[model samples]
Target: MKMCRTAAIAAICMCGSVFAQEQDRKFEVYGFADLNITKYWMEDNAAFRGLRYDDKLRVDLSHVNTYFDFRPNGNTRAMVELSFQGDPVANRSTAGTTVYTVSQGGAVNTVIGTLPLPAAGETKVSETQGTTLEGNSKIRALEGIVYDWGSFSIERAWMEVQFNDKANLLAGKFITPAGVWNVDHGSPVILTVKQPFQTGLVSIFPKSQIGIMERGRGYIGDVDLDYSAYLSTGRIHNTDETRNSLLIETPKDLAVGGNLSVNFPVASGLKIGASGFSGMQKQEYRQRIVKVDITKPATDAANEAAGLVATGKLDPTGIASYIQTKVGEYVATQALNPDNHSYDDVMKAQARENVFGVDAVLDVKKFSLQTEFNQQRIKNQLKNDSLTKTTGFYGLASYKIPMGENARLTPYVMYERVMQEGADNNAGTFMSGSNTGTPGSVLEGFQTYVGGVNLRLFTNFIIKAEYSYADVLTQGIYKDHETVFDAGALNIQFSMAF
Candidate 1:
């Protein structure tokens, strides 16, 4: 860890010196990075075997971002952001009593002991190092780095031609201009945690999409209003790759789209804002052979009450006939088992699809609401299988109390529900590590509820703690099947912005 920090510091100093020398005489350079220290815990006694804290007290330094803007003269400028980042780190338990500190190249402390595991009855985990309970204080997970950090490059490249404060036009690749949290870069002002769930669903957002847009702002009488209209190139995560090319062949591809936003004061301290985007998106995937395995209960009571057989959804006779245990390529002993299981060499069925969606946000003082609803248009011409066209939305509310002068307090709550579509074989559980595509046996849509409190000292340094609960029930095509995988996450973070 010490060596890691030392090398990182040296590299930053070198980069800063070089950049300072290269800055455009009329250009400005600046950006921000989020550095987080968190403890993640999850418990699924049946599936996990026992309670555990994946990466207890771990430190994660997010990707560092630096943006440069060339102001040729007055109201016009070209801007781009270069970024460098490292994966996250977490605590590991060892077979010793003094194992309660987050492992760092630094000294051990009390607040962190083997990355805070779910306190007694908790059942959820956000991020952690996958490790056994055998106990070693050294850090074990380095996956985040292998995948998250690398050579720095222009992550956001765009040019803006502004006519004035009230109007402008922007073109090139850029971040999404919708949702307060969407424009955030590791800052607390945009959220309550290190990341937002919507980011993983970029399948739903047009952020970083290449495009050109027009904007304008002004006041209607005593009220202020802002708006924009844009057109963009198709969303492209598959750029320069075999997977991308394969997607061009799939139905979930984003061929093109248009986006727009409008914000205005509602009344007094309240405000109403709405923004929406629509586009053609499709995903590319490799077609794979699906092996079927259906386990049926001898008694109808178990099948009836178990919630697997929804009304008119499950064909008991057909389901019974299809109950042959055929393992997938990824399901074999060598592939899924840690031991010498030979099932690892099988070929797993791989397929892809494309979809499109629209989303918007509205805020008024202590209450802020955001919603996203999109569907994957079925294109059976490409393949044959049932995929539920999914849709959902989320809302959040927060209140800040200004206590006289120095003390500030805030309380927040948020809720999200993803509706199941008859086509979604996986139900509502968007979580991937587990497979849910097979008929009659699949996980479905996810519903999450979050609430927390925060206190700020001096307004610059903040201590925020939050508790979140998620209930995953009624999954797969119309939420037919059911199980209980309820869990909770508690996180406290310190942040500063300038």
Candidate 2:
């Protein structure tokens, strides 16, 4: 009887331990998805047509995201988000080519042949006469389409430690604490189907960073104040004509930035904020051979010298001198070709940038107003390069109307502008070549007007329809000549969170 009573007590203790553990840990899962259909129209300009989205109706399975939140205890929390995004209308194809070289008795012969097209995600390689040729394929849209295949990415993963209501610490990959639009990044939460030109077209600031941040909030005389400071890996210097992933590149220096905001209780949801970042952006331009041509000047020179010697027109001692001169000329010609160089010929471009912005938001009952202004100054560290300046501003207003129970309608309009000066407007300075101006030249700026309406059927579901018109100032051949192009787009989106 005594042993039975001991077993019962132990069983009770085990149950208590299990309950305590459950109370100490917590987990939750949620996600959001969006679908978009868009129609675009632009002036028929050959220079800009290929670079911009085609003028057609396009449907996209825009974003499918899943989020996980966990709390091991009251003071610490973790969050992770996974996103799958791209257009379903996109497709890809691959083609291959092979080049053969044959050298016999100092006479070289070349032949070009076509190989069977490989399937997607496959590479074809052929080797003949001690020469190797490889055919590589990439993912791209079908002919006349400007869409790409779907991609899976980890959007955010971060952990936070709370020390009190006044102070907290967060670290990992997190979104930048910038203007109002960037923070409300989710499609379900954003009021409009289209984002501001600053955030969408030319990103003055990064979307997120891997680093550490310190944030806190406090009350000051019935006014709420929040502030954050962070240090991150920032941007890397990649001049390979292709963008490099931040996860793979090693940063030369760290970036520092901060945000501060104040909310006034008297104004009823009025908030003002300032955010800025300063960092050095660096890039190294490396020359690489994209193709090998066996019939270069050097080969021609060698062949000529051999023929002269066989014909007894050139002496053995004079042949070296003649060949040396020819080789020097060949070197100069190769240098003119940007691709025929080694790592020792790399060029570097480094610049320091300081970006600052101010944002304001006013919410009164069912009416809301938001505006932001951002400016960036880039000072080139290289000699003979001038300072470049870019500025962007946007203002948005919206009014919400009741549409029966569990439904609401919000109509909104926005105007945004982006301008750049003190440098040539090219692909390197702007997000895209076609959107800015002609290469190695300057143009005015771009301005956009947007109008949209949102229908919220439930707290977690929304439908949006939007129209936008944009004008770009492009430069002509003459210094004083400029032209403007009008472009427009219509977008419809459905978003849901669960």
Candidate 3:
């Protein structure tokens, strides 16, 4: 009887110990919180176009992320990370039309030369407003609002399960695997204060995809191959839910893509990868319309032709007929008038929006270098004949100077350039939300230079400051279409992760 009691007690003690160990493995909590401040020194009235730092400086909570981890064992784990950041869309607008210069050099209210004006009650579409005035003006309006600065939102919420050291599966909203900047996009961790424009605006990087991800890694002949494949609800299609092209609503469609990378075992510092995604981001394209009188010109030209025929300056059978034809041709050539001067929402098929990119990351000792080149093809609905291709690239280099054992200062410099081929000149929309109707509002491309430093006060606290210069390239609508404009700013941030 004593032996039985002793054995029972021992078994109960073992079970209790196992339960305690399991409890310890079931829960883990971690996250990061950060503060950021941005100041604009873009000289008075500098045309930043779509970047929102028009003429002010602002400060807000940059990131507050919390992570809850559930691990049942070494081989199985799940995670949930929530981002609490400021609202990215406090500046959005559903009203007010974005107006653009119809004249060359973005000139307003002044006609340059003998630009003809349509007569009274006639609506004309000109480089200038078609009013019977000195300046003929043309205007195009898009239906949407720009993203406002400063608001709070849930940045990421996803669950990940690891099958083993070499394989894993992730479900829910997750970071895109397009580039290094996106994969390691915490403000406290990156070398710089701001992301590259190309990565943020054009590439599949910097956008969250709601989907499932499968990741695997293995060694091949002294080299390592790491890959991630994902299927997600594609990009948001409604402009009303878009803030700077980032969809703010739940996705309802399928977007499939993946990333494959190779890391060398020779050195722990180098990795090269490529990623691509194809999906429909279709939205209703609202074509700009202006009312114009279509009947008067045809009538006046016919009357003139009849008079010419009667005067015999043109023979009714020969020269008169030719004159009438020429008159009709002239009117048709200048016909800016449409049968219906009302606006129409043509459901434009951004039927196929695809992005492909290659990226390389080098972390050799204390020095790190990152670069990526991407090409995005978006089919143009308005100009159905062509597919708009946007190409962009960025290179960033940084060096870390360790201060004692717990702190370090890392200085970095980066350059980025973007070119949009065959984009609408009047689509003065930008991801940065700066110039509403000015320079970049209708910009084509730009070159940017950014330099910054990150100072770690301790293992958990970091201070970062950066200065950036932007050389804006105007679109075809401006006389200085290819000309370069200047914009510059300073950014400072403080952050902690634990």
Candidate 3: regions farther than 4 A off: 1-23, 72-76, 87-148, 165-167, 201-206, 237-253, 284-349, 425-442, 475-484
Output the worst ten-in-a-row residue range by lDDT, candidate 3: 126-135
lDDT of 3 at 496: 72
Give lDDT: candidate 1, residue 201: 43
What is the descending TM-score order?
A: 2, 3, 1
Each candidate structure's TM-score, on Cα atoms with residue i matched to residue i, is 0.57, 0.70, 0.65
Higher-scoring candidate on TM-score, 1 or 2: 2
Which 10-residue span in candidate 2 carries the lowest summed lDDT? Answer: 136-145
- What Cα-based lDDT does every candidate model obtain? 0.47, 0.64, 0.61
Q: TM-score: which candidate is best? A: 2
- Per-residue lDDT of 262-303 in model 3, one digit per residue for the tens? 987544478899988876564444443543221212354564
- lDDT of the structure predicted as candidate 2: 0.64
Give the best candidate by lDDT.
2
Report the error of model 2 at residue 493, Å: 0.6
- Which model, 2 or 3, shows the larger lDDT? 2
